[model samples]
Target: MDGQLPIDTRPWPVRRDAALHDQTMQQTIGVVTKRLANAKVTAYAAYPEANHWRQRAVEVKRQSIRQLEEHLATFTQQVESHGGKVHRATTAADAIQTILEVAQHHQVRSVIKTKSMVTEELELNRALENAGIAVRETDLGEYIIQLAHEKPSHILAPALHKNREQIHALFDQDALVYHTEPPASEDIVALTQYARRRLREEFLAADMGVTGGNFLVAETGTVVLITNEGNADMVTTLPRLLVSVVGVEKIVADWSGLIDVIQQPALSGVGQRLSSYTTLVSGTRGPDQWEGPDEWHVVLLDNGRTQLKDTPFEDVLSCIRCGACLNVCPVFRQVGGHAYGSVYPGPIGIVETPLLTNFEVLPELPSALCTLCHACGEACPMNIDLPGHIVQLRQMKQERHMNAIGVTRSYRWWARFWATPHGYRRSMRWARWGQWWFVRHGRIQSAPGLAGGWFKTRDMPPVASMTFHEWWDRTRGKRQ
Candidate 1:
């Protein structure tokens, strides 16, 4: 992908409205998420020990985050011992600056990158471009979105919001720019072939490579990348200078720790046993080595992650970015990732964006984005208590008086009303009578006020003429 715009800066409601109204995005996201969610179930079933692995993965991540500093120190020592340099970036600006300095030191003109969410977080491509370095995203989906000047709508599938027809249009424009032919048809094979041809040229010509690490093994100073495409391999091998930007939380104690959680992102995300490619970089190439970068650097980024340690939000750092929660989130299914208006999307994003930024940005994401279904908790391979975190965040917001007065009052009254049998019975009676205006045939077709939004796409059965409590009192009182 080439020069893309900054992340959407629109207000949450406006961004959400756009996603809801875009029929193409809705359909595309719905189909893909549903398919992936179902596939995750089937894949888990096929492996009898899936539950055990998930539990073990959770343990490894929990322990890793708990002892993060110790692991990070070991990882740094090992990487340096192997000739790879380590840069500890305390903020987004620091990370970007470090990478730019490395690129300038090597006189990198053009850079190629594999898919990296961390890079997206730093808006690394834009920063590199600002410094007059040409940056290209090598992942097919990322390249497509790069051409379209958009951010990823889904974590695993960057272009999940796009359909085949829409992709053909983007590719056709690229083909014209390159003075080459477009795909013969809107087929997957033809589209990928065109991309492969274009990216192959960049792979050979680029002076530097950039990647996001999935896991870093402290025992050996290794950076692990799991991908379906071989672009990461090219990025690491062909370029003289290769830089990996990873969250400090990504480091594990050792290879045994890496083994415990490596398959999780693939299995929980897209139901694959493993991605098509897994590349590990221990260091820069040795004199005897025929392939690999001459200069290797790993920028371990904190950027508020360290602030989460020892806090209730620590479980959030365990997220492997698998995106399984998004596939099953009802709210995410309807609104899509762009609506969340962050680099990350879905359940994890809801907790992460607010936490990473310390709720200074998008303070409403926790309360607004979740349905509290707990499906995200079940779907997470790391067993991150996403729903629990969201609830706590919402509580934090409420304590800070971030919610609207009217909404707060409404929920307060509703909770009070439902706390006792008498109030509940009285409210049910009021609802039965008050719902008459909206009721037609056998259900409440529409509602007034905030309730209206729910009824817009869903109908509710009218409150029954007699509550179970009332019926039991009338019938069983005589028998008693």
Candidate 2:
């Protein structure tokens, strides 16, 4: 439970209690995502050759995952050959224990970490801190959220929910402990500079550094960390021992395959032509090289991913963690990451949670949070049909009798009506009449039964006077 404290603190009860507080989160994510989406539009227009590259990237990822086990073994061997240690963790507990053991053996008192969603999913910081090690997050967004005792609301932008004023307040709070006062005026650049100076000391003093792998190339035995901020580079190179945690699906066959999967989505997701820093560390620094950590370790985590390897959901392995899907998802835009109640949020989490956990206990998970808009599918670099996967999960829930009664009844009623035209027409007429109570000025302010929630935030279109079949009959009956 202590290991899960960070996650439990932000559970459904906590999130619901904090929902109104998340209006700020909603606004912040909306502005950032919309801006990024628009930037993507302009960026794609400039790189007209992106579509060609996207298709190639998809093929490369598909080929890599198809031979994941073999490539992983090859990657392990190459890493070992280069004087790096490899640990295979079949479960989350094993991964955490392995990292903690490494930290303890090194007598690590303080650790610096780069932004890694894999570590977040595993709750690594809490695990390390519980083992009596002080862990500091080096990424600017991650550091802010860490101090605030909050989870990252977005994958890429951990503290996207925080405004400048909130940041200034946080810095001021920390300044009291340091017996120094922050600047009176609130500015992002100043705040960032202060954080950098503080983190620079932590970077030098920390016994170990930890990072999450964006991709693991089998041929070169390299763990790649892509970032716009260069925090990953510092974390990877500065400490005495460097520990990298990588999901099993992150393994690629070779550098060529790694390059393809990372390039397109890295740009599209963040609106960057390329990440400013792409660090590839195969092992520890040689005696000749003064920079880089003295010891390197890679922990490859299965963590339920193996169960999904060959299934219909296998395409999920193609995700590069660019987070474009989160930026484009309408439901994610509304509730933000905390409402989903998982470390991985948005479209990816909808598909991932069911596969990774006890779905029977969480039957409403995939359906309750999705709009079935297929926007995530369009944004996906590997062309993973995310909406189709969500539907598949819903079907699984139905077959297992895990679906909610309301959902089951609704589907049944729609199936029956669509099968019979006369029944459908009569239903539509009844619906129109029933909606009269809520209708005013040709818009429905409220609706009866389950649909009322839908009208709460959106305008419901007025029903048409006649069905399409009836209009077709009236116009072309003689010709028929």
By lDDT, the best candidate is: 1
Provide the overall lDDT of each model, using Cα atoms, as 2-decimal numbers.
0.90, 0.83
TM-score of 2: 0.90
Question: Where does the lowest 10-residue lDDT sum fall in candidate 2?
Answer: 1-10
User: Residue 111: error of model 1 in Å?
Assistant: 0.7
Model 1, residue 211: C-alpha shift (Å)? 0.8
Provide TM-scores for the models: 0.92, 0.90
lDDT of 2 by residue, 1-480 (tens): 111212433445466556546777778878988887777778878897888888988898888889999999999999999889999987778889999999999899999999998899789998999999999999999999998998998888888778888888998898887776574568777898889877888888998999998889999899998887898888988888999999988888887777677776567777777888898899888889898888999999887777777888889888777788888999878778777777778898888777776472334558778889999988887788889999999888889888668868887988898789788887888887887888888888888667878888987877877667778889987799
| lDDT for each residue of candidate 1 in 1-480, tens digit (9 for 90 to 100) | 011213567998899899889999999999999999999999999999988988898899999999998999999999999899999988888889999999988788999999999999899998999999999999999999999999999988899989999999999999899888888889999988989988899899999999999999998999999999988999999999999999888988988888889999999999988888999999999989999998899999888788888888888899898999999999999999999888888999898887888777777789888889999988888878898999998999999899889878888989999999889988998998899999988899999766888898999999888878889989897887
Stretches of candidate 2 exceeding 4 Å from the true structure: 1-17, 181-184, 358-363, 425-448, 452-480
Q: Which candidate's TM-score is highest?
A: 1
**What's the residue-level lDDT of 375 in candidate 2?**
92
